[model samples]
Target: MTHLKVGDKAPDFSALDEQGNRVSLSDYKGKKLVVFFYPKASTPGCTAEACNLNDNYQRFQSLGYEIIGVSADSAKRQANFKTKYGFQYPLLADEDKAVIEAFGVWGPKKFMGKEYDGIHRTTFIIDENAVITDVISKVKTKAHSEQILGD
Candidate 1:
């Protein structure tokens, strides 16, 4: 699948949240969205990214944006991560990689000279109408929320 570009309609998906509650992309219609795809739950980079978003979550809400994190982690892992970090947003469990693949975030990756398929740290800013406004591909985990909010 091609990487989604600005002006592309954000792909709609439904997934289970950390608490096993159903979440759908369409559920947030008429609100801007920050749909972030990370490699795993509780990993250093992922945690940093998630925490950055959590820290600035109120600001995001003030700006009329709903934040969501997605990964191939199980619901239990996502629940633990959210509780440990006190995250206010939902972390969707994409254990089947369906949502990740639809967003073009699941692909080959290399670490320590070993190539494997995994989620690429990426963020999509979608408008109220579901059109993607920006694609943040090379995300800096520590300053992620700042970058997303254009700080």
Candidate 2:
């Protein structure tokens, strides 16, 4: 989970998107942003979350929120995942873990009784001024959009 909370100043960072183009938090400075950090790209859980957001992309747009998915996946892998799922949003290829660390999403994790360091699936909802408004630590992957937007 993120150490930063609501009203906290989100760290500014930059990374390559799936297309190898540079993108940064500053680009969305004057816009609402949904920056979600996931462990990897194309995995079942990740895909479910991304697709759920993609399915509701227009709804988010109408609500004035731009979404960006971040993972430590390579650019090629990110591109493949986006293409396979027909996602409308950009997926940041945080291969160097810059964004992940800046957001404090990279840390210890456990699965099947094993422990290891990894990126936690978390979402930070930032307002127009780049201040975090909501942080989703426990994401409901399939219903992620609903989790963010509510009923």
Candidate 3:
């Protein structure tokens, strides 16, 4: 679970995108941003969530929202995932977990009765001024766009 809340200030971060481009929070200073963190790239749940968002990319854009995906995957893996899905937004390759940790999404997780540490899937909706407006901890992968859109 995330320590960040709806009214909290989004933590600043700088990381390399799939294309190895340096991206930072400041880059989106004047735009609404959807920063979603997933446990890994190319996984079933992650794929569904990402694709759902991409499928409604135009809707989000028309509503003045820019989306970005993040995971602890490498640059090559992130690139492959983006290319495979034809995602219109950038996917950050947070190999070092810098951005992940900064957002407090990296923590203990359990799967199939096994305990381990991993990135917890989470999403943050940020306004143009960089304040978090919503935090979705229980993400619904297939209907994620609706979750974000409140539809």
TM-score of candidate 2 to 2 decimals:
0.98
TM-score (C-alpha, index-matched) for candidate 3: 0.98
Q: Please state the error at residue 52 of candidate 2 in Å.
A: 0.2
Q: What's the ranking of the predictions by lDDT, best on top?
A: 3, 2, 1
Off by over 4 Å in 1: none
lDDT of 1 at 82: 97
Candidate 2 has an lDDT of 0.93
Q: How close is candidate 1 to the true structure, as a TM-score?
A: 0.97
User: Which candidate achieves the best lDDT against the true structure?
Assistant: 3
For candidate 3, write residues 1-151 as lDDT tens digits. Answer: 7888988999999999999899999999999999999988899999999999999999999999999999999999999999999999999999899999989999988999999999999999999999999999999999999999999
> Which ten-residue region of model 3 has the weakest summed lDDT?
1-10
Pairs of colliding residues, candidate 1:
none
Cα error, candidate 1, residue 30 (Å): 0.4
Q: 140, model 3: CA deviation in Å?
A: 0.3
| TM-score of every candidate relative to the true structure | 0.97, 0.98, 0.98
Candidate 1 minimal-lDDT segment of 10 residues = 1-10
> Mind giving the per-residue lDDT tens digits that candidate 1 earns over 1-151?
2379999999999999999999998999999999999988999999999999999999999999999999999999999999999999999999998899899988788999999988888999999999999999989999998898888
